[model samples]
Target chain A: MFDQSNHLPALPGVGYKPQHYSDLLADPAPVGWLEIHAENYMGAGGRPIAQLKYLAERFPISVHGVGLSIGGECDLDPDHLARLEHLCDWLNPASFSEHLAWSTHESAFLNDLLPLPYTEATLNRVCAHIDQLQDVIGRRMLLENPSSYLAFDESTYEEPAFLAEVSKRTGCGLLLDVNNIFVSATNLNYDPRAYVDAFPLDKVGEIHLGGHDEDEDDHGAPLLIDSHGREVADPVWTLLDYTLARSGPLPTLIEWDTDVPEWPLLAAEARRAQTALAQLDSKVTA
Target chain B: MSQSAFNAALLNPTANRPNGLSDAGGRPAGKRFDVYRNNVTVSLREALETGFPATARLLGEQNFNTIATGYLRANPPSSPLMMLYGGGFPRYISAIPALAKLAYLRDVARLEYAMRQSYHAEDAPALDPARLASLPPEALNNARLTFAAATQLVLTPWPIHAIRAKALGESGENPPAHAQPTLVTRPEFDPILTPLPADQGDLCGALMAGKTLAEASTLHPAADLGQLLGTLLASQALTDIHVEERT
Candidate 1:
């Protein structure tokens, strides 16, 4: 097992891409740490795991899960939970996080981070899943809020309140994805700032900043899609600054999954995040 | 709404929206459900495209998308791991009536699947060539070799290697009308495909079936045994060898 004491620094990191493995190992720039999709590295043995072994030794790794489907309807899949346990046992990353969304139902695994109605029933289901996940992995995982294009009228609780109650119940931390908040707010016509203010900042252990695409909703309102395919948008950066001002410089990640640019471009995004963290530090010192 | 009913509607767009599903403003949730449906289908299609690039090229993007939708509806992913998402795709392609005319399409899909398997297969140290050379001449015939986990053999009736090469832009010319047995091995990090002769393929097949060198050589009498052994060694495909003594 890796040393769990070495936590990820409250600095900037990027989602690790296999294509950039050699480049990262060669230069390894000033990037603080690395994050990877947990499912991508769940294979038996291969380059992904091998590269992770090398990188895990040098940096504080973050295992961001995409397939846990924690908010799914049925009981959490035991097989999937076992896979997660095996991976966590081996890597023992500095932090582990998963989405507040569900992707599996009736044995059909949808590849998207889907939205769920924020009702008391959903809160109970999500809490149960998180409890099982934490028990299986033996770690306090962080749950990230989802970006949705629509809301359910059946939802009895607001998204922030639902997440806050979940954290309070499950004793798990939160991963405040600033871009998701912005996207959901724009799509739902809510104040992103208000959403952040209502967010349980004290429970936030990490922060995410990613790119989004602009599309019109059914009502012709501006809809922000959490695309994660390009550089972090300027507004998202400003939002990150806003989030960090309250969260006090949580470990930030610059995520670029699709249309992955060259190394320098991604590293520059992380540098921008680092700039935000540095600004916060400077403010504290001043 | 019941969880099962909601998931069914989410996965199948044509299904009627579940009861009690309304937007925050109390409007019908058709548009919101459509967005989620689009996300699910698009992401699954992209996963299929990534897994079967050659098949996608052969079928064309539009045609592949149609087939992918059918496959997705028929065989939803059993696991959350995207790397393991398209396990039934090759079989699905083979069973399609329209794809029957393209007999080799399924093989090409298999080749792509094999390459992915080799890419993620377990890693092991290659058996030193010196060990084989040092074996006594009398013991050489009884030596059973163990291959690296990343080594895979695909004996196909189609020129899958050539077709894959052409599809990947590695070759500009069309594939020849001859069957080719391909060997996939990841000696280092990246997996490589090598087309083998008929006799060599038979010999490898025999060896993989637990036949010793002498038995495997006999199975392909006309094969150049020295060349076969040399190629296997050079590719670092053999991981272990043991001599079986006969009384």
Candidate 2:
């Protein structure tokens, strides 16, 4: 009874942190929907679940999983998959997505979105995991691009190519994290626009913009950490315009996870995103 | 490199950033690797602090950081549900020698953990007190109380309730040295810690162990069954009551 299209409105949304619960409801203004970290709401009940239920009625929630470890060598945890099924069965969110990075090694959950080495073997494992996830959740899922600080010697495929092939194989969609594009591009010495140009824009279901921390890697090159703690960076915003120009407008989320600011600040960010989406809507119609 | 090797090095900041990792250039990636190390430890440390705020306050911020760092390394979360992380932390603090000076610290951690657990515990509709009131005294004596999923009883020798209250700046009195059993009850969304006297704690414990009201009341002569029941009712701790019929 729960199978339905996994689509979020092509507009601005924000990652729902508990701190913003009251303000998000009070005056969300231009936020088209909300996205929740699946791990945070996995609890059986309480304020988290209560708030989700109430908000789900009013907004299209996108369940974003941060700990699925889709790229892990170990087989996907059946219990974790079951939790996802339960959440989907209940929330039946407008969209569901997890990262291309793995966060677990065996039973230990590292709780960080660790990078993956792009290879045929890794592709096979990720596709298998996505297949299992879709099968169990009974919904198409979106695989998100990771923000990388370093490259793996073992990787054979470019990041965009690997993502496209995974989507093609698993029939899953892609979530283009725009900030990650800029972060990875800067850290790895590539053009963010070119990465967007090579991306399979047709497959992108969601777009994400979040804050990154600036640091220097071993050789004094810029290293951008996907901190998600501050306002969306300016260059990352430019990349979003580039992506939206190509993707033509998608459900763009302003993700502020750590040190989440007051709601008005986040709402302002959402308003900016809304303007971008509104402009695209007019262009597509024009 | 193997994920196991990566995992081993990720948790141990002291471990050599190790060879075989790299930046975009072929240069060895020691600093690039520390980004992951910093992310893992720092993020998990913050999570631990959130899960045990009272404990964090009881042990000063620096001491809590030291213990949390040690506890996190010894017991990284087994599941992705960070809300459920630090289940073993109370026991972890008990074994630390440096914290041994703080006799109440372990139980305080346990109390804080229980509060967090109860905060996220399943919501259940409280049993209407009128039902119990309507029952005849004899039948009520035979009745078995079913506690709400969000209710927890943590028995500790330290006055954890007073300590938490003082930590929260709700009171100024240094908690008198006495055994306190904290009853964690979520009347709404926030879990409330109520210190129960020994007799009342035993009475609640008995009810939790499937003892009937009469049987539970018998365990503690000093327990004010009426007042205790009133407190539970006010907290919405009881979800249902099944009074046995003579058969």
Candidate 3:
């Protein structure tokens, strides 16, 4: 019931951070939208709310949540949902999204986006949680793929297939994290391009670009860690370009959470995405 | 795996400490699990470094990281999105026996945490100076003043305001060697730290306890009640006011 073709802008965007507020507000970039971690603005009143409110007025906003724990066995958290609902009511963002992994279980929250076994039982539980979330927030949510460090033995389906199945079951969209695909594919020794091909492109509402770090397993197999602290690597850029060419234009975000550089550095990253999308679109027309 | 077992595997990895997992070739996967657990612990400890940089700096990074890891192992995050996490770290720091020598560390952590809490608290307009000043001298103290949602008072024995600034690379000698109560509030989208006069803190505390402004002023009659109200109003700390019926 919640289908909106214009939910996201065609231009590139960056995750909003207050340190860059002055830069973003003083000289509004050509960036399309500003995405914020939903929980950051859950407080009743404060600088986060004020600056976010100011930004939302100038650019489209997206509420990307990190703690919903959709894959957990427990029922959806009501208080967290209420806080999300309040944020949605105030921000009126363009699109909303959360991860496909669980970060909280029982009562302890590990504070890391951990992997979940891809199985029918888990799928059903996640879909039900999404339904509850949609009902509470009164809007559809886009579930993003997670960057996994380890694959569980109990998993039954591939990542893209699982995401497509979840979208079909829950009537929700997908926030395809291309960086996650790169990281997971490298860590698990799968082809990133093939994973993208298998993804439900039409259901994709957004895309994420970030950096990954290299590590090795006990046997010395390469492990790609989704650190999101550095610049986007050459191969990930190639993957993003390929995906954009196939899927057409979608709202993309450059997320650099750690070692956050100066505003101009991030703005340059967003500009790179803009150029990539533009080149892909031109190639498609040619 | 049952739902509970799967959850145990993911969330409570430290519960049974190390549940052995055997692969197809009979190799133990517990070592990999241990690595993942340690990474989780370190990641959270680093988050505290960002959340409470001043506290971490005051205790030095090496000592802070070691103590933070222990605190995290005992009290892991209650939420995945760390923006709202770390509320208990300040109190947890106080309970650690080894760091007890730095008696001021806990209060510094509390002051820093309160700064963050105030930074994300809420935005509310302060009462206009014109309206506040128009109140009768007698009614001024009797009027109940509401604080902005972002205002926070951290009554600490340490000069936290100075210590926090120094940690931020600001140039300043620590405040006179005396315990100072600090006021933290995001009056205009930026957190501000100010040292409060001893009597003024008691008055602010009285107001925080829902005391009528008149009652608060009565605690410190020498506090230039008008100017105090004016300064708080200008700081966006005074949000609302109502005359409390004398009881």
Clashes of each: 0, 0, 8
Native-referenced Cα lDDT, model 3:
0.78
lDDT by residue for model 2 (B1-247), tens = 7677788899987887655777877888778888889889988999999888878888889988988998888889999999999999988988888768887888888888888889889999998989999999999999999999999998877888888788878899899778789899998999987888877888898898889999988888789999899989998998999989889
| Model 3 chain A weakest lDDT span, ten residues long | A1-10
lDDT of 2 by residue, A17-40 (tens): 888887877888899788999998
lDDT of 3 at B153: 86
Off by over 4 Å in 3: A1-5, A25-30, B1-39, B167-171, B213-231, B245-247
- Model 2 alpha-carbon drift over 4 Å, by segment: A1-6, A282-286
Model 1: fnat (fraction of native contacts):
0.73
TM-score of each: 0.95, 0.97, 0.89
Model 1 quality (TM-score): 0.95
Judging by lDDT, tell me the better candidate of 1 and 2: 2
Sort candidate 3 into its docking category.
Answer: acceptable
Q: If the candidates were sorted by their TM-score against the true structure, best first, what order would they fall in?
A: 2, 1, 3
The digit string of per-residue lDDT tens for model 1 on A39-156 reads 9998878788888998898878999999988988878888989999999998889999999988888688988887788988899999999998999999999999999877776788
Between prediction 1 and prediction 3, which has the larger TM-score? 1
Shares of reference contacts reproduced by the candidates, in order, are 0.73, 0.80, 0.46
Q: Give residue A90's error in model 3 in angstroms.
A: 2.6
